[model samples]
Target chain A: MQSPTRAKKKTKATSMDIAHRAGVSQATVSRVLRGSPLVNAETRRRVEEAVKELNYKVDRHASSLRTQRSGTLALLLFEDPTPDDSHINPFFLSMLGSITRACARHGHDLLVSFQQLSDDWHADYEDSMKADGLILLGYGDYLAYESKLAHLVAQGTHFVRWGPVLQGQPGISIGCDNAEGGALAGRHLVAQGRKKVAFLGDASTHFPEFFARYCGCDAALREVGLRMNPALQVDADSTEQAGYEAAQVLIARGLPFDAIFAASDLIALGAMHALKEAGLRIPEDVAVVGFDGTPMARFSNPPLSTVVQDTSKAGELLVDTLLQLVRDQPAQSITMAPTLQVRASSGG
Target chain B: MQSPTRAKKKTKATSMDIAHRAGVSQATVSRVLRGSPLVNAETRRRVEEAVKELNYKVDRHASSLRTQRSGTLALLLFEDPTPDDSHINPFFLSMLGSITRACARHGHDLLVSFQQLSDDWHADYEDSMKADGLILLGYGDYLAYESKLAHLVAQGTHFVRWGPVLQGQPGISIGCDNAEGGALAGRHLVAQGRKKVAFLGDASTHFPEFFARYCGCDAALREVGLRMNPALQVDADSTEQAGYEAAQVLIARGLPFDAIFAASDLIALGAMHALKEAGLRIPEDVAVVGFDGTPMARFSNPPLSTVVQDTSKAGELLVDTLLQLVRDQPAQSITMAPTLQVRASSGG
Candidate 1:
């Protein structure tokens, strides 16, 4: 093998080199080399010709690997054993875009795997020899997968997980400032004189996300001189339909809530739709706020006022943190603060 | 080398063998083997012990190659160089989610590579002996990466792309019916008594997606006893801000238009915001219909009426198509039809 210094010197084709030959924005040149579709065809052709003529070979992957990366990150999503994949929320889509972009910026690629709770495909898994790190998403009794993940950690694989890390498992976990977000919602509703505010969450479990959000709401209610209304707290599956059904059930029980705070944007949208069908004017008859600054929030009817966590930043930071850990660098569990984006539904 | 059959049948506890030993999904076994975080710790332990006891010697580099597979698919995204991974349209996200789901269901992983119009990251690409197939999404200009892709095809790599098959490109192209989506948008706006409708699309000189959408809208208008008033055709750079500005320009020109058909959900959402801020009521004031059944469409203020394409099917079809091509089977282009999802935005 060549000396490390010699290899590094020989492989240097800096961004400046490509820019000089391509005669475009260094950013444009980077985009060209990154194979982004943002540029024009004419520009791409010129850049390619320049690259071929200059013989500029950029070992993005090797460098990433040397920096303790296999130059790849894995996104492990829990697969539900069902035929219909329609129930999937768009949050994954948004998160994926951010994660993919972050990987590209660092000159790394993303590898994704899905874990379905089935038996026939096990024969296909003996080939697990790629990737330097991982970012785990998805849910549904992933205890078995978490155990294997723990083993990988024991074997020194660099990884970071969002949501809950397996009980006391060693890994970096990043999540939204759920407590703050919940408090923001609670305060906003109370400020609008909504004494009878209701809390709706997607899951019944005491996952950190749900618990934090719930706690924040409780704290906010306490601060605002209100009592925690247990009867107003409802558990709904995090879906638009579920939100609608939950709201319907509450209405049927003769609940008189002036405002509703749902944990997710999808659930909020569904609640809004149900409220509309029942001839209720948004913010006039009842106000609503949702968490998850999903793109859907911006476009929701009356637009949803919700907590917008910086997903792109989160994705970028997650990858960066994992990369640093891979390089034997110290890392911390990162939590991003959620911003309250006030919209029509939230009395903006 | 030993006879191919002998090599394949050599005694090694394959994933299937281990899966048979432990009653679980094949995908789960692959997940555990890959150290996915979606499995339970107990199941992972069982699989790990099985591997150790059975002496499963999995050759990382050779497994995918030996089976003529990387057990992974490549996702080629055409992206613009944006600070925050430019506002990804719902269509792309929907397609990506479906693709990811399909790869998961079929016991395969996904390798995502973003190819911009002006740059080429062929360094890592050259070494990515991984990935048995490629799924091209949001690739605007085929010429940028088509040749390299062609070279790979000639070298007997199996891949499938979305959208039109490039002239002389050897691969499968599975795409949503752009023409149909355009027609549906046009028809919806027209049916709502909106006469002077304008078409907003992304920049088309570089990539063909916008152009295809434009052609489809034109065809629909022509069928409905109308023609694009040339002056009403607007092109923005495919950002919310751009869409907002385009609507302003159109409004400033006082183009005789009572409707607007934006090519993407993002563009449509921007246009809606711009129109609303300018005191235009949705549907009642100027009906709007967007293409791409993004989740945002369902949540948009007044709920956007748009065209929904089956992205999951597209992903699955791409994989199946590539596998067939790898087997030297004849595969044809698949065009998926878009269904019109009526919502409040279209005044439905």
Candidate 2:
């Protein structure tokens, strides 16, 4: 058998060739190639078989020029505060899967890369016609990253970000209702008869997602005729070690806190470790709740109660929104609803 | 600030233009653009500045035609037995991070996609010149996937996979010393006075990695004058749920086991969950050990004891091997040494 690599050196196969082999009209072959629903299943199968036999590839560059569309999207993952060199947060990795599937569904290839905030990274992918638009995920310190978003905006780079849907933000964003997620955790803890709830995450304007979650938790406290104690709030980056240290700090302060609301599951896992080490029984002494229903939450010592961000919806919306921007359509920011998953740690 | 997207409509700046602006020869600019290390830091910086100023791209298609290189590598992740729709194993995800970094270091853009086993998936990417070569990870049931590997080899696809290094394997592969890792776990468990050991995972030729691990465990047992009881072996796929079910099946068989060795960390976690649910204490009633030292292992209820595959080295090796193939260099299979990370579950 001739090596396919060597075989490719010959004249490339075209859709017309596939159509001739499949005994179908060129138009039918085109419909199958475009993944048009108008094509019958048997015909599509025949065309696909013909394509496989001939090893035909649609010339992406030629098609891109003709349609003024690259048929590719770039997923730029900004470096996050990770405990290790991986830099990717587990939550974003989950989102990556969804986004990849969503892109596949929409017949687009994805170009993934790590984005450093310091570099002139924004001037490459889309500007070079490598990708039609960009989907941004996990920007550490939104306040610092906001200027870069404005820079992208001024450059007319079609893009969408997965973050807190703040009014007047520089670009279209698709995010979970972080405030509602926080409120869910807060309400659950409060109903469990926990008076003092500690928030363990960077809760400031600089970190809009965490800040929104904090606000929601605060609102829940207010609803119960209680208020979040300023001293109970410990600012920590989204990491297990940071969460562990934050929990230790909270413990050191001699504050009477019976519950904790971590902005992320990683933080909650670390806090749980610290609480266990400190000889505090979960739920009996302190109830804990976390956000982002990562897989780790399901397998934690006592399953973690967390706010489940609908990653499937988020992925579809991100791709849809970015595609709209690529088409010069007016795109708007969308906030997805969050669901609270009550597990053993939350005394459910 | 003109939108970069809009500005892209103008003729792209050329290397000659950058050379003129930087007061260097076009060859020097080309060397800098190609990421040749021969260029001095000052000269490279000057050329980079000129590039930024003129918004220059090396015209990938033109360069590709001249060099027969796309300057891109495709990282194809095969679907694994995942508990959720994500279909990604955490261990491979870590490798993905390392591979991405390696590609960037080599001045190659990485195009990542999930591969389904049953498809003409191999006909695209490198065949279309979208990527220069491929780095494959995760193939569930190697026996079934072996034909595909052979097909890839027959087609002369320049690719490398992460799997067990065995004789007659179709292509160059980079894998961990699974047998050695299993022996390490076995020796540790034996030292802790465990006699009857249960092995969770398919221990057969169909799954070479797990089979190798089981073989090593058998060797360790032989050294201790104890033979592995065939009845104690339970077949399980890579997922946690599979592990959980495997553990349950082992328990139901009424086997007298003092230790359990899982093929992967996910399986170990699931087995641990099952054992705990059955009211058994880890490292007391039964010592449990797993392979693949993922981040989750560090935070598992009783930090999991397992074998740590050097993902960094694996990534570097896989990319280097694939590049060697792309350059028509003879590539050899490599097996990285695995280190045993003895944690709480192993009574370390």
Candidate 3:
């Protein structure tokens, strides 16, 4: 095996070297290198073979130097309130796959890391010129992180974040219409003849996404001339344990709720387990709905019903918007539409 | 929000500038920068405040030039043979979290990307000198990718992969003892009085990890003087759908198997669904076991029993080994022991 470090010391082959080896003109070599259709397949193959033989590399650094851009983007994932050490939210993992594909499609390299909220986090990427811009995902508490976002803005950092797309939020943001998603779940449960629907997730400013979802659900219930019972709202994070404890709390309250709408699938799955342990049959007794249609939702005991965010579109838009900011172009916040995925848990 | 691009042009403050502002000597500044721990808490706090105030950067590029090393590691994830567009294996995702943390602990930046099997994939990092070394994960078919690994080896690329720790493989690898994991599962099944055990996974050389697992299970069965029924093994990939189909195949063959050991949690989950659909009570008519002990296993109905690889240890070893190779030190392959997480599905 050849040592790559030793091979790198050898001078890089130029297009002229390929042209000499392939017995083609330099212009033809350039045309082939540019992937111009003007070059025929036979000639292109010959040029490619010569290029491979010479171990040539296009000097991306030179191009980057000219543009003053690293041609890289950083993805900062904030720790989620998970039950285990992984800390990553399963929903973010799905979104990560889409974002990676989108970056590759747009000719950008991605640098992924956990969001370190310390003062030096920005210096780790942007200040070091490792990436041109940043894409933030999974802010634990929106209110707690709001000041940091403002600090980033004050420093003139080019960033886009995934969160509730509310007015006056810092920087460019891309997110699903959480309110619409909540309303969709509420309507579905109401249509199933579930009158007393309980909510499991913090519906406060600290968790803006859950709050928006709660408002939407509230509006949906009110639209049908029914008011949400405050006693049925239980605060919980997006974790199975949190959901389980919240359900226990709701059960302890002795509220006669017939349906439960968890802000996330992890929460809903935990709630289902708790309800089952309490001798309640899903859908037949207490219908359930969840947000973030993760793969686990499909395999849940009753196959959870959820509001599906368009991750592919979300990823594409996030990358595109960040690139726009990197290039000094105007980028706007975006809120994507949500679709309901009805499964056995909701009696769909 | 401040524009990061605009902030880039501002002359960055130096350690001397920080020292002057903090009313400390340049030597004291250097000591604080190196984290000598000799400095008093009050002095450290003052220096840190000054450093933050001036927005100072450590000029990583200057240090990198002195050492011919990029101070970065690349993690290449090969697309798994999954049922959906998100080709990432859940097991690898868990590994990713550990690897990321390990990199941070070692003061190295991580560059993450999906492994594109095309020829230019190596050029994406090693040839370009973007990263000092590579940590590879998830090779779908070892045989198909063997030549590529050889090419990387010939090029003197510093890389370590997660796979079966066997002789004659092209490069260094870190993996769990698949054979031991298989034997552990077999012994547990035997203890449960399950004599007829079905294996659902491709146990051939093409998938070395799974093949090792089968060999271990075979050895354990032989030790107990119980031969494995060749007709009971059904080939399937590590996916829920594939597991479901393989189980159906096993059932159709009229094999009186009381136990099923799947190659992955996904497969076991799928098999359990099929068994429930066919009205077979878990542990009464059939018991199931799986590998990769992912989060989904805990949540699966009846809960899946699985072989849990120490991903945290594996990640640390993989990073440590590759760094050894990067520093021109002798690095050896490592095999970690697996633990059996006996859950409800196996009647544990």
Candidate 4:
């Protein structure tokens, strides 16, 4: 006599259900589902497992459409400042890779546009589609783009400036602890018992990276009761050839610095070439240390000692910071610690 | 007043208009727009110019939807390979770069997947999506996921294979003319009166590259009236360390090779390093030539003489070929010509 009709079981888990299960807000559950790093990994993994078990499928496009948002991000890189060897600062390269990977894991993709200072420049085609956010790389002279970014921000566009931000701009940035890295390098050299030390840097300004390294080195030397030998500190053209010439000039002047700190690994490697050619033994005759530990640092004849920036993590952080801004959340400016990888040349 | 109505304006330009302007057929216009190489360069350029001038946007997404096809292409690369340095094969790197660029230019983005053979793993995401086509990097005998590819193909997913096809399937391949490159090296050495010529390469089977190069060298040596020297040939692991060790082995054997041709640039560069360490005079005692012509080729000391393959062009071609296959159109295999870049290392 009982009716055969039984309640149909629920088909799939929804965001609210996942949220309740994970003991987090629905927004946090959504963020976890979207692979946004704003949520801690433990929470995210739990949410993801729940999603898989529940066989939940979120219609991202529909939600984004309702909000009139494209759910897409644009990566704008300055093609003009591309170094001579097309050696994009490993920092940017690693950052781009991380950002792209992060975006992909979140079921989104980046529309990349490279702009150069050359003639025939135009706004990126995707500009009309209006991306949800932007990851700006080396967009020098933020003043020129201030109105552009301000307009987007007013329109609810979220973005993170991956490179240095201009003063007075309401934005977020993630960069390396350049000053600390510099200080680490300086202290390493000073600790090696080099009473006389020189600083060789590339021709760069405005980039917090170079300056931070310089300042760190400066402070460390001051703490160690030593100052940069004015006669020995020089700015090279930032090429291997330039480093060679700088070393040659230093050697020619008979500057008796027992140690040197170069701003870039390329320059340090180049300086090493020059020093070796001049019959000077590395670390023994003149201890040399470089910043930005590239793969080349290890393979060098005696190996190079340098400060390493976690480029991939920097990239991930840059994207994470940008996404936070996109979601109308606050983002703290972050500076990553530099890793000291000591090799033969740095007397480690 | 009754005749005041204006004729309805055309909403879009048809393929006919593009073909007419480009002096080709509607079919040709479609092919050109799809990046088919069958169209002559001038014709393709005309069609492209017309498409740009008209601001014609090919809604590839909508078209894929209409055709009930997945518009995405899969680019499968080894996540990691032995002699990790081999990953720097400029040819493959260039091809990857080109394919990515081409896909973007054509309003498509590649779904890149890493296949590590040791894991015997398959990509479930790509398989479920049934990618429109695949552009695979020819490396090792990683087991093939044929059932997956077959399933997609059965579902009307047209596909194009790059590099050598597996099991002699009717696959289209685009690669550098390695044999020709090899012959060029052989002839150059013979012309310089090198009686003994050594060939350094990696694995024999996976190295279709080495085979191609060897073919060219064999031809060149025959033309130069020189016999092959089996004693001078060595197949080493393709790594800097391997090259270094191979060089030592070659020298210890006291084989009189006046010239050497390494299968890849890394091998050549490594060999050069070892030779330099051994105090052998380059070009005088052992002129060296390298294959693949990676960008690093130009930067090597003595500026390594190499056969340069235009990686960007290769990238463009790979995309073009894949698009053709995606459209259910006939695709042709292509060989990119490798040009000999004469540098000091080969004594040229």
Best by DockQ: 2
* lDDT by residue (tens digit), candidate 3, B1-348: 232333344545677899999999987987887688899999999999998888876544543544457788998887654335664678888798888878878988888887655435754576656688999888487888788887777777889989887667787888999999999999889888888889999999999889888878777888888856879999988878889999998898996989998988888988998898889998789999999878888877788899999788888999998999888877888889999999889999
- Candidate 1 local lDDT, B268-327, one digit each (tens): 888988898899988888888877677677777778888777777777788787666545
Task: For candidate 3, report its TM-score.
Answer: 0.87
lDDT of each: 0.69, 0.84, 0.82, 0.65
C-alpha-based local distance difference test score of model 2: 0.84
- Docking class of predicted structure 1: incorrect
DockQ comparisons of all candidates to the true complex: 0.21, 0.32, 0.31, 0.05
- Model number with the top TM-score: 2
Positional deviation of residue A301's Cα in model 1 after best superposition, in angstroms: 1.4
Task: Compare the candidates by lDDT and give the number of the best one.
Answer: 2
Of the pair 1 and 3, which is ahead by TM-score? 3
lDDT of 4: 0.65
Clashes of each: 43, 2, 13, 5
Q: Name model 3 segments beyond 4 Å from true.
A: A1-51, A58-67, A80-83, B1-52, B58-66, B80-83
